[model samples]
Target: MRQRNFRVRSTVVAAVMVFSTVALAQPAAPLPATGNLQPETRAAQALPSLAPLVESVKSAVVNVEVVAKVSSSRGGMGDSPLDRFFGGGRGGSRENVRQGAGSGFIVDPKGLVLTNNHVVEDAVSISVKLDDGRSFPAEILGRDPLTDVAVIKLKGKVEGLPVVGLGDSDAVKVGDWVLAIGNPFGLASSVSLGILSAKARNIEAGPYDDFLQTDAAINPGNSGGPLFNMKGEVIGINTAIVGGGTGIGFSVPSNLVKALVPMLEKEGAVTRGYLGIQIQDLTADLGKALNLPVTEGAIINDVTSGSPSAKAGLKLDDVVVAIDGQKVGSANALTRVVALKRPGTVSTLTLYRNGNKQDLKVTLGTRPDIEGIGKRTPRETEESSKARVGVSLSDLDARTAQQAGFTRNEGGALITDVVPGSPAERADLAPGMLVVEANRKPIRSAEELAAAIKATPSGGTLLLRVLAPGANSRFLRALKVP
Candidate 1:
């Protein structure tokens, strides 16, 4: 019986081995041709693959290696904006040489590579490694921290370098497929697929916060990589990702990069056109208060003395509706449009003042260096008055004015208290703030502010030019009277 069982098992094993060999030898069946099928059926049968697109553009992507010396007293090598998001560095007694890696794409045949500014910032030595295994030392051409864009030139480059074409970021729509090729976590030639999750994302990274958000698995080493659209055109440059969140990444739009690249390459820095004015978005309440027909545009809060806007006659409460025929939908839009023009270029601004539209041609000026404002403690006031708009105000005395960073002769009404749930509190009015003007008229005392509020018609709006304590600039606020 045992001999019979052993022979049966051996036979079964031989049969199974023979069947596996035959199955392995057979080739995969070809998919049926869809040429003669119905349109819907054909679409269903043909699956889309990014293999061809990847093959075409992958050569343009390169790896960037940086070596820099960082102080031990500071956060060390990982103290950069990019490193803060990804995390690195350690404290020590002496300065240390840190080596980091990032990614970039060639934008010119002469080895011009566009990347994020933080990638090669403060680098003592830089190297670029092509996807085709070629490597060369590189030098920083220029870098702009405001836009987080940088241009680097590859040294000792011969010829035939693959270059990626820039695409119109304005044309990109949400949900459009995007490809991100980079060296994530030092893994070279890594490709990720996702859609343009959002556009014009303001992550507060810089003054120009317009970023294209995507879910394309952007990692630490992916900084400064190119984000490609379906046409293999670069639409954005991957700059940042969420700290510990998945499927959330930010890229600087290519249009912004395109605007900055020429200046960066030629001058090694960006010189933006400046109109010296503090502005804010025209909200619905502000529009209604100003009796504006439309609730869009940038409302001038304060005009810098002797600045371009001041010289052009722009004043507080003026609403800029358009710039050279381009609509200014928000304050940020106005800023971006103005900054794009070269200094000394005359640009026409269409604005609304007193419910009338007017155009002003003003030559742009170069942006000046920003001065810091020092903070001071709020001084006590003896006199106080209550207003119908639900706020207690006091006279802005000379000592308090100087402490608040204003001239000792400056006259205004200081807010001593704001009623909870009242219009004052709702408009973000808080104690220690000074009301400099009411309805475009200067206020010298708490009684003057109360008089201005009393003069406003029932259910009307009270426009206040307010100077917050310890602030360097003034802002305009519209409060509705009950």
Candidate 2:
């Protein structure tokens, strides 16, 4: 036979396979004399199906339709009868209408539906269609953009509506069978089968991005749909998928939904606990530089002034090992634990500073809205000096300091250029970064920074605190000296 290769295209397609088993003739094995052992033969069992599970939960899955007003600057509208009748066809109204479709599921017998925020956000009118050909209008109850979860209530007398049973997403494991029901391409009651590929996935979709990854065939219209376990319980909400990729999709875990739904119903928004600290995961290189035994905690990069963390005396370079006795293995783990706590909660943090362990109680505050950093023009200067770490440094002038969101008194050695393929570049030290401190000592000028670098023994690590331009945050960088 001629050898040939086949490649599968990137699209969501259903596949089914069947196998037939045949018995072949074989010689019987001789039995032992006294204690003979016999092999047990069992009948072949039928493959499992999702038909009954789909039938029981399909009624709760709904199709969400949204209409919003859009502003267009186009000259005239097309030849629609309504548009011509409304605006005499000269320069039709600039206000146009847009429509979108998504999926949702009923979570309350009183007609309360759970869906994604992007589906009904900014919608002028919203309507929901059921699997039984019943359509009803819906109004947004509350939405949390941070988590991308929304709650909407159907209008009119919607008594005895079918509701989906919520499952414990924390109990789910990888490789567990899962089913997704949604409206794909406006086709209502569509179902897809897959298995849980992973958990606690952070796709950078949002700040709280603990998503359940699956290989389900979720499409554009599957957002806000329910991802069910074999027990016919909603374990996740279908949320995102990779563009131009097949069998890769993500869903919001149901536990997060369960936590936020009641709060959304009571309040219009969610208020998360704030630590007021910028942190990053510790790496082996950073651990070695910091003289730590293990790299399993989140290292504090910066503490906001007058914030909860600052008030609690949490300083820069402190490694948080645990929060409220819960081990924080990574930066994301710390973030999730802190954000799950309510405001005004006094939580104990186990942290290490200078290789010494300590505990501190911090009363978390309400998380504020994320502020945008402003940009500043970089000042050009001819005077520059070279540091041993392959970086060109310059004196930070008062004017340049103030322009870079720093006070005049906070003078430091500004990095003007970084040599490519050098230790400085490898440590992520770039131009436009201001080196404030070296080895726990303040650096006032380029000459001071050079002196600090030279004082360090050859082949030793130099820990430097630096601030990026256009932001009010500081971070530590560890560079190995030659």
Candidate 3:
């Protein structure tokens, strides 16, 4: 139950997709030099219907069906995109088989289809159905779980397949007309219309989560589908939707897809260049604390010993402003740039160190395993007899904070455990969560938290400012004392 709080721009449940951590190469066609793409031209006559466009592009869309062995206790194909919509995020004990379905589109004429990793990952058998009612078995060419993108080849494809045009996602702006084509709720090839609601959204799905959000009616079966612009170009791959929420859906930008497909097809895995540094977006508080004149870069929190940064003389608290002359606005930007390049690439980094600007040449190394980051550890079960609010609280220690992925400066009481069906669970508090503030007051220990709870009025709603490890930001929650 690892979840990153992307509470409306802030909630995402972190799904651990087991895959190779290596990064592959980007496509040969580089991104456009600028965000200034030519505006789409359209006819002046009012179009009567979208029938012509749908007829032209619908054949490129596809429905994907998969069957795999799963735990009988869990009852179905593991955590699927549709699982969020259908309420099925559980696994079982006995070995059993399950079925799942989603959508995709042909990217190459020779049957190169693109879909989500979650759709066909761990699948024992896969079948794809074209819009023209032709079904064929599909073979996975490669899968990059990190990006939620997978490349599958449709077997027995008699040449001459229709391909959806890939569009520039950077050129896509809010309020643009968009159409989502997919199988929603098992509805095959269903089309929904909406406007681009947002862009470059970090749904906290992954570090490179530059998603295109739309108000389209994307539902359970819509995962791995295509999001198209009015010009009938595929701009996004529909991936996620807010459960039970109206008009909120997200797609992986097609530009990322275009960049990833070539590598996935070639290497069958992706490799990321690692700098061996933990970083965060420079905050005004950090800027003031560090005596900095500006707060516009990524601040190095820690540099791993014996890693590339250590060898490159990179230090803790170094603010990385640019890499290879490209501006790095935040931690994610730096991460995206570094991760996309191959290992052994020497990159020049402009850094602000102790209020002094400097440049360092760093040869990027392979990023090691990050899958264990923020994983839960066995807590010391030293407990008090009394329980207030049915929550077990412990003093935040360095070990607890590190295991929870919190920075060294973060101080708080740790929610060690939550009793089932209790107020803590109702308030969405869980183990490994740092309770930084209670009732708007900073709490340093369990004793302080108890005092704060005692200070609250009886049956009053207790306001909590909580920071979960690996989360982008702190969030507010309220619990009514019972």
Candidate 4:
């Protein structure tokens, strides 16, 4: 199969897992004899011994039910001064709870199960129901929201349980037949068959979004179930499906979990190496401008000072071609490869610099909590208009300012909150930094900023160099605004 590295948005997972190369040659084997069935009946049998394989693994699969408790807030004036003094300004409170369900599979005999992080997050109570209808309380061991993977432990001993064998998802070809067995729509033990559809898709769900795409019929309740190959090995964990498609689905490769489970069991969390840099896909014009021979690998737009990349002497405008011999052609690929390394590990990066290949060794650092970035909904794009100078503005939040390495001081329209996923976030226009100018025009409030933006000609470019915290930093960005 094609060994491209790509991140997948949730639905994007179903699209990329289908890209596999042609099948390789292998010797065919003769069928084994059945003892009880008549000799003539062998010709009509669909599968020789699939029953034993299914029976062996079924005990490990489970149905997960979760309940989350939510508290409601109330605010109003108190009836009396004395009552207000005792109870404060807030009134009575009400408690509410929501129920959800999902699926999971036991990975160890001691009762450790694997499921999606989103499936059991914030749950106050979790229970796992086995195939024989026996249920046990489950406790979440740890979860990785960036990858949407979670591990949970169950009470009591359950020995001799058949564990699903993990297969190499990187080796699974597109035309290879696969099976998906899960509790779909709450239906017990639903089995669906399909072929690999694509691989290495960039759906934009998270940084490390690599997923296995399949045409297997997976639905709402199938979230953590296993996607098996013909040999009954778990190649992937069924995770998501396209909202409108019937047969399109996606799964987390079993290989990824194979690497994650041990770490979760030991540390109660997964630690990943980080190199602070902003990267972008290589475009034809950009490639030619950089004088690079090929439009492959990710281009470094900016590198944070004092970061691991900076310590390694990585520079802006450098193109990363590989990481420790692993080829990376996209930003998602770079993220995934970096995540595979430990925090203290030294990684060698092969980069294309001014049309020459050079190598640099970088001691990686642990990534900070990144669950909040990329969580905001994408902003709407507007028609571009040319206007006189003034800085564009948005609300000031701790997150916005921290990204720009600035302290939250002045409020009002913080620069660089516009949508459409561009370098505005890179322009260093962060929240808490007041927008002092637009097209060279002084802007005092939102009204002035709006007026300045409106004065620009429709379908033209606008520029604003704003003063932010620390040294007054200038901001530059281009957009079509209506």
- TM agreement with the true structure for every prediction: 0.67, 0.64, 0.65, 0.63
lDDT of 1 by residue, 275-297 (tens): 99999999999999999998999
Best by lDDT: 1
Off by over 4 Å in 2: 1-45, 71-95, 371-482
Per-residue CA lDDT of model 4 for 183-256, tens digit only, reads 66566676787888988755665778888899988776677788888777888887767664556787888878
Is candidate 2 or 3 superior in TM-score?
3
Off by over 4 Å in 4: 1-53, 70-95, 373-482
Pitting candidate 2 against candidate 4, the one with the higher TM-score is: 2
Candidates by TM-score, descending order: 1, 3, 2, 4
Error of 2 at 354 (Å): 1.4
Whichever of 1 and 4 has more lDDT, that candidate is 1
Task: Write the residue-wise lDDT of candidate 2 on 1-482 in tens digits.
Answer: 00000121111223435699765796667755433433331121234566888999999999988653334444554333212212212345444544567889999988889998767654555789998888887767777766778888887668768899889999999999999999776767889998999999988767788989999888767878999999999999887777654568889999999988977777756778999999999888988899988789999999999999999999999999999999988899899888878999999999989988899999999888783212111110111223244677888888767765565447788887775445577789998899999988999898898777767654578999998887678899998764
How do all the candidates rank in terms of lDDT, highest first? 1, 2, 3, 4
